[model samples]
Target: MSRVILFNKPYDVLSQFTDRNSPSPRATLSDYVQVPHVYPAGRLDRDSEGLLLLTDDGRLQARIADPKFKAPKTYLVQVEGIPDDNALAALRGGVSLKDGPTRPAEVERIDDPALWPRDPPIRVRLSIPDSWLRLTIREGRNRQVRRMTAAVGHPTLRLIRWRIADWTLADIAPGRWRDA
Candidate 1:
C-alpha cells in the first residue's frame, strides 16, 4: 500500500528536503521528518504555509498534483482589504493573471475562528482593513492565490492552504506532520 503523509509546513521553509545553499536559513523536512523514499506531491512556496502532502508512490503524487485531475485546493487568505461582492464573484468566475486566465474557483468570505496566528504577523496598513477569504481552486499555478487576490484589488497579506481534495490541515499545528 502506498503511504500518504500530510505535513503542516511552517512559514519560510523550503518545500524540498535538501537545500545546501538557500539564500535564507530554513527548517526543512529532513530536519523533522524521518520518512525515507517519500517525496512531496506538490510544492508550496517558501513564503506560503500549510498542508503539504508527501508520498512514496510517484504515480499517486502525479495524480494529486496534476491540474488535469482538478483536485480542489482550499486556501484561507488574509487580504489587505475586504473583498466586495463583485471581487468575490470575479474570483469565482475566474481571474486573469500574468500566466493566463485561471479556472473558476469556489470562493467565499469566511469568519474563521480556528486560524492560527503567524509567527511574524502580517503587516497592517492601519487605514486599510484586512479580511479573510476562503478560496478554492482546481488549478495549482505558482503563486496563483496571491496573483488572483492582487488582480481583484485585495492583495493577499497572508495565505494558508487549509485543504487539498479530501485531505485537510485539521488540528495540525505549524511544523507538524502526520500519516494520512
Candidate 2:
C-alpha cells in the first residue's frame, strides 16, 4: 500500500531535505523527518506555513501535484486591509497575476479561532488593520496565492495553508509530522 505523510511545516523551513548553502540557515525537512523514500507532493514557499503532503509512491505524488486533478488547497490569509465584496468577488471570479490569469477560487472572509502565533509576528501598521481570508484554489502555481492577493490590492501579510483536499492541519503543531 502507498503511504502518505502529512507535515505541518513551520515558517522559514525549506520544503526539501537538503539546503547545503542557505544564507540564514532555516530549518529543512531533514531536521524533523526520518522517512527515507518519501518526497513532497507539492511545494510551499519558505515564507508560507502549513500542511504539506509527502508520499513514497511516485504515481501518488504526481496525482496530487498535477493541476489537471484540481485538488482543492485552502489557505488562511492575513492581509493588510479588510477586503470588501468587490474584492472578494474578484478573487472568486479570478484575477490576473504577473504570470497569468488565475482560475476562479472559493474565497471568503473567515473568523479563525485556531490560528497559531508565528515565531516572528507579521509587521503591524497601527493605521491599517489586518483581516483574515479563506482562499481555496484548485491549481498549485508558484506563489500564486500571494500574487493573486496582491493583484486585488490587498497584500498578504501572512499566509497559512489550512487544507489540501481531504487532508488538513488539524491539531498538528508547526514543524510536526504525522502519518496519514
How well is each residue in 1-180 modelled by candidate 1, as lDDT tens digits? 999999998888888898889686667888767899999999998889899999999999999999999999999999888899999999999999888899999999988547778888789797999989999999999999999999999999899999999999998889889999
Local distance difference test, candidate 1:
0.91
Candidate 2 segments whose C-alpha is farther than 4 A from its true place? 21-24
Residue 26 Cα positional deviation in candidate 2, in Å, after optimal superposition: 3.0
lDDT of 1 at 12: 82
Question: Candidate 2, overall lDDT?
Answer: 0.92
Candidate 1: 10-residue stretch with minimal lDDT: 24-33
For 24-139, candidate 2 gives per-residue lDDT tens digits of 67688998889999999989999999999999999999998999999999999999899999999999999998778899999999885577899898899999998999999999
Mark the regions of model 1 whose C-alpha exceeds 4 Å error after superposition: 23-25
Full-model lDDT for every candidate: 0.91, 0.92
Error of 2 at 107 (Å): 0.6
> How many residue pairs in model 1 have overlapping backbones?
0
**TM-score for each predicted model, relative to the true structure:** 0.96, 0.96
lDDT of 2 at 52: 92
How well does candidate 1 match the true structure in TM-score terms?
0.96
- Give lDDT: candidate 1, residue 151: 99
